[model samples]
Target chain A: MLVYLIRRIGQSIMVVAVMATLVFLAVFAVGDPVAILASPDADQRELEAITTRLGLDRPIYEQFGIFVWNALQGDLGRSFVYAQPAVDVILQRFPATMELALAALILSILLGVPLGVIAGLKPESLLGRSIMTTSIFGFSLPNFWLGLMLILLFAVQLRWLPASGRGETVEVFGVHLSLFTWDGLRHLFLPALTLSLYKASLVIRIAQAGTREVMLQDYVRFARAKGLSYNRIVFVHVLKNMMIPVVTVLGLELGSMIAFAVVTETVFAYPGMGKLLIDSINRLDRPVIVAYLMLTVVIFVIINLVVDLLYAAIDPRVRLTESKG
Target chain B: MSKAVLDVKDLSVSFRTREGLVTAVNSISFSVGAGEVLGLVGESGSGKSVTGLAVLGLIDPPGEIDPRSSIKINERELIGLPEEKLRRVRGKDVAMIFQDPMTTLNPVLRIDTQMIEAIRAHEKISEKAARERARQALEKVGIPSADERLKAYPGQFSGGMRQRVAIATALLNRPTVLVADEPTTALDVTIQAQILSEVQQLCSETGTALVWITHDLSVVAGLADRVAVMYAGRIVEEGPVSAVLEAPIHPYAAGLIGSVPSRNKRGVPLAQIRGMTPSLTNLPPGCPFAPRCDYATDICRSTMPEPTPYEGGRAARCHHPLSAPTPAAA
Candidate 1:
């Protein structure tokens, strides 16, 4: 087991290295770094100074080495556009996006899985068929479009909630609350719901297909023959078997949530890493772009690792294989 | 004879597909006496597994069972029972072991979790007791280190071991009726033989009415007390194992018996069934096997014969049952 874990950790390090290299290349590959510094008002000396200060005057390899070293040492350099520390900029904006994505994920799992399971168990029933058809529509509708629809219906028509931002004012327990937690959740509802619409459909389809496949398995038949209640069979036996593929989808979806939330974030005018990354890209903010890209890579790798661990917990066979290797 | 443990009468099932309502199991009647292993032999889509599934009320929706279909276990009608009540009957009074052992056991769960779940599903047993019974059941099925194996996942075990675990699960409740649908089909020959003998012994010892559904005639011949030959959706022939194997009266049965490679002596060419069974949808007029049977005549092709009793506890469904020319002697 120890040997297996060591191997997996070794593989994880390699994967992270590959991801870092890719992010570095992608950030630099888009356009000339010196062009942004060269403006109509800037003279030759100013251009040289800006280039030297930003380390663009050095060899590409040296620049990349410096970037990696500083990134590893918790120094993400300064944003070219924001003129603030890239790490600070990311940290300031990350919580809002995280809160929104987390809410969306939770809602998807809560609403989509059960609906999918019901649809799969009774494919011919009116409720089941209706749920399936609605899920298909849900999947086809884009997140940004869904966000717009929610804004139109709930924000414009109903006036029940604010259209955007973390809320007008923040207070908790008769005290001024932080925008990161309570206020963020209040303002995040519409965008989160929009984000959840597509994700919920995905989760439903995956869960439904998975549950359907599991239901057809011989063991399910065995369980039925054993006189296990329909509820027990569906929830206990079928759900457990169906979770393998569902977990895989959920994990990938979670990783993609940070990236996929770009359009939704833009629509809501929300302050998140996704919005920060997009703004940085538009202004050719290399440092902030690289930092955000690295963070996205980290999130993807970390979530996948957590999912692998979850897989191990769910199935001893995977654990055994890990141990054996 | 002992009292009938499972009495299935006029059981029929049909699926509402895009094409039409395709009949999977026609009105078939059979009874399994307590402590007797009735072998249900058929090829793929012969409705053998469907019949077994129907008995437990496990048939999914869109596949409708005839209202007249009646399945009684220990004189209790199971057909049309609500899902809640049916759950109590299944795995308690009647349990099934499916064909693929790998899929029969939940892949993600440990043997202990699955087995104990099965045990506690019907009984109000403590976890400790359930665990102990699971271990005992595994041991009973000849699995070495049963306690250790209980903690292992289904994928951790070999195919044969998984089948043993599945069998152990079925026997955990000491069900009155045990339906094993090609349980040993996925195992190696030696493992299949071992499992077959073990199941046969367990059934007889516990007085459980066993229905061993398989395509292997030889396996059933050695294990079952009585055998039923299903063709398409109906039982074309049924009788004592000895009577059916030694002298099959039905043309399909004779063809099936002749097709067994082992039945031929050394240096003799193996006999093969001439044609495939007719499709369930758009079946030929009259007999389902008429298109396949070489001995089928105008009368055989025009009229489906009802199952007629033969001497010495045997039955056959054929218009000219005794008219076939004898094959070269073995």
Candidate 2:
């Protein structure tokens, strides 16, 4: 097991390195950071002095070498806009996005799996058919439109929820968390629900398909023959088997949610890394973009490794192969 | 004879498909006394497996059991029994084992978990007591180091060993009736024979009524006291194993015995059954097996024959029952 983990970590390092190189070079190829930063009224000499100070006067390769060396020492260059270490700027907004993504994910799973399993077990029932129909709408409806509609209904018309902003936050262990308070949750409801809509639909379809297939397995019938209660058979025999793929899909989805929940963040004005990354991109803030992309690569690698381990733990077939290797 | 532990009468099952209601098991009746193994032999789609599933009330939506059919376990009516009531009966009075032992045991679960659950489902036993019984059940099926083997998953065991685990689980509650559907079909020859005898010994020792469903007549010959041969959803012939195999009054049964690859039947191409089992969706006007029976004639083709009794309690469904030398018969 240790050997397998080490091998995975090795592969992850390679993935992170490739992503770092690509993002670094791509950032350089884009719009001038100096132009975006220095004022238009500044004299040419003043502009040259700013460029030299920022290490942009050197050739791209020399600058990249220096950046790589500094990054190795945990120093991504300071953000042009915030004038703070790019990594530190990202860290400050991390909790907001993490909480939102986690809220959405947990909500989707708690709702989707049971509904999907029910639909699968009784695919012909009226309730089951309706569950499936709702999931179809869940998949087809755009998240942005869904977000706006939710804001319009619950916030604007119903006056039940806050439409935008991260409401009140309580700090714990130097981390900002809005999810603990009822008022904060009320504020968070619209955007989190909007982000979760697509995932909930996906989970429903995956769980339904998986449950249907597992329900037909010989062991499931055997379990029934053993006089296992309907609940036991459905939960232990059916759900456990169906969860393997769900875990796989959900684990990989975590990274994507943290990295790409920009639209939802924008709509709600949630202070998350996604919003920070987007603002930096628009301002041509190379240091921030490069740091964010590299961090995303690290997160993806970690999630993939964690998912692989979880897969092995859930499936004895995979576990056997791992031990053998 | 011991009292009949399982009595099935006029049992029929059908599946509602797009084509129409496909009759999978036509009306059939049979019984097995305590400690008796009755082999239900048939070709694929001849309703052999369907009968096994029907006995346990495992037939789900799209498939319906005929209301006219009656299944009794130990003189207790089972047909049309509420699902909750039937569930109590399952793994307590009656249990079923399916083909493909590789899949019969849940791959994700350990052998002990599966067996313990089987015992706990029927009894108010604690986990420790259930685990101890599971260990004994494994030993009863002749699995080596039963206690240790229980901790392992089904994937850890060999194919034959896996089937033994499934059998051990089925027998955990000492069910009055054990319905096995082609339990040995997926196993290798040696393993099949071993499991066959082990199961036979286990059932007789426990006084369980065993309905062994298989297409292998030879397996029935060795393991069953009586045999019922099905052809296109009906039992065409049934009698003591020797009586049915030696003198199959039904032509279809004769063809089946002849087709068994034995040294005695070798070099006899004439003995092989000529055609496939008929499709249930669009069957002939009369006997379902008429197209394949050599003695099929005007009456045989035009009229379906009800099961008729012969000497020594043997029975066959045929207008012209085959005889060794019937000079006067068609």
Find the candidate with the highest DockQ and give its number.
Answer: 2
Listed models, DockQ each: 0.68, 0.87
- Segments in model 1 whose C-alpha atoms lie over 4 Å from true places: A18-44, A81-83, A137-139, A168-183, B323-330
**TM-score of each model, paired residue for residue:** 0.90, 0.97
Residue A23 of candidate 2: its Cα lDDT?
88
Considering the two chains of model 2, state its CAPRI-style docking category. high
For residues B1-330, what per-residue lDDT tens digits would candidate 1 score against the true structure? Answer: 578989999999998888888899989988999999899999899999999888878787678889899999999998878778888888889989988887888777778988998999999999999999999999888999888888888888999998888888888999999999999888899999999999988888899999999999989889999999999999998889987888787888888888788734778988888777677888777889988887788987788888777765667678877533232233
Model 2's C-alpha root-mean-square deviation from the true structure amounts to: 2.1
* DockQ, candidate no. 1: 0.68
lDDT of 1 by residue, A1-325 (tens): 6675676678878887898888888878888656765787888898899889888888879988998898789887898766799888887777668777888888889989999899888777899899989998888887778888888888899987668776543545543333446555667788888888888898888888888888888777777777777787787888887888788888988888876588889889887778887788878888888788778877887788788888888767788777666
